[model samples]
Every structure is written in C-alpha cells, then in structure tokens.
Target: MDRPWGVPSPIRPGFAQAETAVPLMNIANILTMLRIALVPLFVVALFVGDGHETGWRICAAALFGLAAITDRFDGQLARKYGLVTDFGKLADPIADKALIGSAVIGLSVLGDLAWWITLVICGREIGVTLLRLAVVRRGVIPAGRGGKLKTLVQSLAIAVLLLPLSGGFAAAGMVSMYVAVALTVLTGLDYVGQAARVWFAGGPGRARGA
Candidate 1:
C-alpha cells in the first residue's frame, strides 16, 4: 500500500513475481521521491529572487544540495537494505535529469547561465537516458563513478550560478561553471564511448534475443 507520502508501505522484492517480497518503503526510494518534489520549490525560489544574487544562489544551492544528499542516501539505503528495484533504477536517473535540467533551463532563461551550457548538459542527459532505455531490456548498468562525478559537478555548477546577487558569488559561479563545462564534455565523451562499446562492439548481442 502507498503511504500518504506516496511511498509503498511494504515494497515487493524484485521485478519478477517469483521473487520474495520486501518493503518498498525503504529510505532510498523515499529520498529519491523527495528529491523530485524539491525541484519545483527550487524553481520558485530562483524566480522569486528580486535581483538578490547571493540569495538566489544560496537557495538554489540548498535545494541542489538537498537533492544531492537524497541521491546518495537512496543508493546507500538500497544497497544496505537490499531494497533495490527496477523502478528505482529507472526513476532515480529520470528524477535527477528532470530536476537538474529544469534548473539549467530556468537559469539559462534568467541569463544566469548560457543556453549552450544547458543545451550540452541536457543533450547528454537525454541521449544517455535513451541509450539506457534502449538497453534496459537486456541488462542493468549500475551507475558508475564517472557518472556520479558528472552529476556532482553539474549540481555544484548550478548552485554556483544561481547566486542571489553578489560579486563574490558571481566569481565563484564562473569558476564552477567552467569546471562543470569540462566535466560535462568529458562525461558526454565517456557515455558515447560506452555506448559504442556496448552497441557497436557487439556487447551482449543487442540487449537480448536479438
């Protein structure tokens, strides 16, 4: 049953019915959902800023930080409590993309960030997500360290760029944005290379029975 908060009280274990049942209300999934919910609040905060750069940055960073915290917690809880699910595998990344991508778009529209930066980041995200969906039927690829690093940098950059209204914050934002750009480029290459190896290199023969 789903709780008032929308979490299933007792999660069924595994994707297949033959698997044993487990509680779905694990901390990880809860945190993942919470992160998704926070995105709107972050957006409102960003837009509400009356030209206060520092205020905007701090609020945005706090939102991103909260999301980041949940990102880590959910994974840790899933692993520790044996509550990992296919739903989680799909929802986590989608939630992340939605949250971060929206922030990027919002910031870009506000001229706090360049459209090209958001474009590059969103492009990679959309591409990777599609690739994952394409290959999901065959096997699951656990999130790797490089992907994690990319997300971390992206979040930091978004936070830095959203400062409310401060010169020091702007300087910091510039530095962070450059770092994020580098990471974004590197990660895009890494994902493309991985896709090549998986699809072109005949890895697993095209996700199953192909």
Candidate 2:
C-alpha cells in the first residue's frame, strides 16, 4: 500500500523515518517557473531596436538579472523549507540553462559577444548535464562550491556583456567572460570525476553497505 504524507512506512527500529512528500507547487518552484518564463521576454528585449539600444539592452540585462536572482533564491528556499520535489529538481536546472544559454546565444547573434565563447560555455553546460543524467541512477550529485561559483561568475559575465557598455567596462566584461569559461570547463571536469566516483561506488545502495 502507498504511504501517505507524514506516515512512516515499514522500517527497522532505529532507522530514520521516511521523508514526507513535498507539494509540487511551492514558492521555490514558482520562482523557478518565473525564471523560465522570463527567457523569452529577455530575448525579445535583447533584439529590440537592433539589439544595441542602450535602453533596450538595459531592459534585457534587468530581465536576465531578475532571472538569475530567482535561481539564487529558489534553491535556498527549497532547502530551507524542505520543499524539494522531483519537478523542482528537473525544472530548476532546465530553467538555468535556458536563461544562460539564451543570453549567451542572443549576445553572440547580436555581435555583442564572440561565438567561440558561447560555444565553449554552452558545450560545457550540456556535457555536464548529460553526465549528471548518466549517473543519476547511481546518486544525485549535489552542486559543489566550485559549481556555484561558476554559475555566479557566468551570470555576472552575461549581465555585463548584455549591457551596452564599452571601453574599460567592455574589456572587463570580456575578462570576466574568460574567467567564467575557465570555471565552466574546470567544474565540468570536476563533475565528471564526481560522477565516476558515484558510479564506482555502486551508487547509494552499495555506498551504504560500504
């Protein structure tokens, strides 16, 4: 029989209780959804007025920044409130990739950023995502500090590049982008290593035995 929320299923004495179910809709999930919804609007703002009008560029950056802020809070809210759900797990990363990918790609298309940079970052993101899925059955790979830092750097770089800035400010944006790309590659390698460890440990089941 299916166990109801807060109802403990059969377990050996001294074992921890089964976790209660979290609702699919919650503040954290709503924030993630909002981030995803902003992507299209951000793209539109990016392309408006030949994609270079200072006003429209600011609008695009604001939209992107808002989306990134949501990314920051949603995870915290989920963990703090014990509101993590399967849907949130799936959608949160998708929303992040969509937002970042769109920003970089749109900037490249608009000639604001280089294509190689976009390709490198996007490739790494896609590769890491695939690695995560490949090892998901073994265990969930929580985001490490390095990964969080990389995301922060990437979002900041994208926001700077999205703005209609030039001179030293533009140079700084490029420099930050280089740093973001470096972190992307480094963290991707780290994730691959973590996945390998999880797979070798025979997943959670065998790890518990060990």
Candidate 3:
C-alpha cells in the first residue's frame, strides 16, 4: 500500500533545524547576485526624476542588457564548471524575475506600456515561480525550450522599450511585448499541466527529503 501523508504532529517549542549546505562566494553565484543588484539601477535610470534625459534611457538599457548577459553567463558557467549549488538554483530564478518584472512594471508606470499587459505578464511570472517552488521537492521540473524562448523574447522586448526612440520604433516595441505576453501565458499553462501530470503519477511524495 502507498504511504499516506497524514496530519502532522505539533512541533517542539524553540526547535531549530540544521543549516543547509549552500556554498558561497563563487563566481557563477556572484554573477547571479549581480543580476539582482542591477534591477534597482535599471529602475532608477529608467524612472528617476521623470526619466526624460536621453542619457538616462541609454543607461537603463545598458544596465538591463548587462544583467541579461550575466543571467545567461552565470548558468553556463555553473553548468560548465560544476559550480551549481542549492543557493544558485534558488537565487537564479529570483534574480531573473527581479530583472524582468521590474522592467515591465517600470514601463507601465512610466506610461510607456499598458497596465493590463504588465498585469498579465507579471501575474503569470510570480504565480508560476511560486508553483514551481511548492512542487520542487517532489521532483525537479527543468525549464523547457519554450520557457527559454519566452525569456529571450521578453529580454529583447524590454530592451527595445527602454531605448529612447521615435514613436514608430516605440510602437514596434509594444508589438514585441504583446508577443512576449502571449508566450508567457502559454508556457506557464504548459508548466502547470506537466506538474499536474507528475502529481497524479505519484511523483511528489518520492522526493520528500530531496
């Protein structure tokens, strides 16, 4: 018979668990943290003091572009050098969200993009991240190719929107953003559907201590 996940007993008062062994101060992990750090700079350059200066727009786009590069490089380094750690696995996605989420929200707040579009994109991202964490201990659901493609589209769209461009060029960026939003919603549903299948097949309980 399969074991049941029965109700839990009460925890002892003041009990503390052992610390997980998450390595620190590695180059790959540094790059991941750098991406997170860049989000604030990107926001500031894009929105601070009315964001009208051409120089500021250029700075914002440059910061975002650098952050995106680090995102790609960090993962590649981790995989190539066997530097992957629990902390990297957790922090990396959070960093990506901070970068992309901040970009979309900033654009909307600046009246460059529509609020409804931002709502859909950010909602999907935050919801999926939480869902992934909830079921991660059950089994790892690696990023699919479609998910990577969505990231690429989002990066390009955000960069285009950040640039100080003519009205026509800016409108083109909005078109790209809409395409990204479509992919974001589609891939998010795909992920949830896959997780549901895994749960139905008894995959979650198998990795209780993983």
Candidate 4:
C-alpha cells in the first residue's frame, strides 16, 4: 500500500517475523544472555560486603565492565554472522541498559557515585528508551550515530569507574564520570530531538493516530 509520500510503506509484518525465524541461536544472543545473567551476580556482590569495602565495589565494577564488553562483542558478532534478529536488536540494548543502569544506581547507593548523577543518567537512559519505543517505526531512528557514540563513551566511563586500580586509576575514573555525564546529556537531547522530528512527521504519534 502507498504511504502518504506515495512510496510503499517499508514495514511488512512478515519481514520482521522472517528475520526472527532464521537460525538466531548465535554468539551474540549468547553474550546477551550472559549479560542478563551478570545482573544478579553484580547485585549479590554489591550486598555481600559492607558498602564501604573497596573489594565488593571493585567486583561490581568489574562485572559491569564485562557486561559492557559483551555489549560490543554481541553487536559485532551479530553483524559479522548475519545474526541480527529483531529479538537481538530489541533485547541487546535493553539488556545493556538494565545491567549498566542497575550498576550505576547500585554504586550510587553504595556511595561510589553521587545519587543525583546516577539519577540523571539512569533517567535519561529510561526516557530515551521509551522515546525509541514510541517512534521505532517510520524508519526515523535506527540507533543512529550519536546514540552509538554515547553508548561507547558510557561503557568506557563505567569500566574505568569499576576498576579496582588505585591512585592514577582513581583519577581516571573521576574524569570518566564527568565525561559520561556530558555524553549522557548530549545523547538524551539528540534522541529527543530526533523523536520530536519523527513525532511531527506522524511517526511518533502513529499509535495515537491509529
């Protein structure tokens, strides 16, 4: 059927289902499952020791780093192996956010990070995710360039902060913290701006229109 622009609509129900039906059991999905599994282990580590103890904090950070690394590895593997199913596309980022956001909030509660900062970061992450859900159709936002850069920076920042390395590493973590904050703000704004464009284009508000 012709869309408003007289071009055929890009979405077809069967296309996405077909994409999902292919052999999807792959390394990328495995890594995503691994990341999901790490969440509870991370929480357990955080609570196992006194909140002030550096050891537990370091372990939480390390688990966060590994999950972040898996984020990259899974995406690359999916792309390399043609394993990019709709499920993978949807679940990979959500898994990443759940793991990272949890870590950030946990660390903040443990006094590793400032509460407001964690709130801001996590809030933006959730808001942008909802925005994406609102406008996933109409081909407006395809996990565009800015979003990818933001994730990369956020991952690096989180990894550095989680490291048990002392002295110089501590200084590095401080820098990473601020860097992460800045990137989070920029990326959040970028997502909103894009969503606004899509909203105005009848894409974002399509559900309501329907």
Give the candidate number with the greatest lDDT. 2
Worst lDDT run of 10 residues, candidate 1, spans 201-210
The 0-to-1 C-alpha lDDT of every candidate, in the order given, reads 0.71, 0.81, 0.77, 0.70
Q: Which portions of model 4 show Cα errors greater than 4 Å?
A: 1-21, 199-210
Worst 10 residues of 4 by lDDT: 1-10
* TM-scores for all predictions: 0.78, 0.85, 0.82, 0.77
**After superposition, candidate 2 runs with Cα above 4 Å error:** 1-19, 202-210
The alpha-carbon root-mean-square deviation between model 1 and the true structure, to one decimal in Å, is 5.9
Error of 3 at 94 (Å): 0.9
Going through the candidates in the order shown, the clash numbers are 17, 0, 0, 0
**Residue 1's C-alpha lDDT in candidate 4?**
33
Query: Which portions of model 3 show Cα errors greater than 4 Å?
Result: 1-22, 198-210
Query: What are the C-alpha RMSDs, in order, of all predicted structures?
Result: 5.9, 6.3, 10.6, 8.7
The order of the candidates by lDDT, greatest first, is: 2, 3, 1, 4
Error of 3 at 139 (Å): 2.2
Worst 10 residues of 2 by lDDT: 201-210
- Residue pairs clashing in model 2 are none
Any idea what lDDT model 1 has? 0.71
Give the candidate order by descending TM-score: 2, 3, 1, 4
Which candidate do you rate higher for TM-score, 2 or 3? Answer: 2
> What is the clash count of model 3?
0
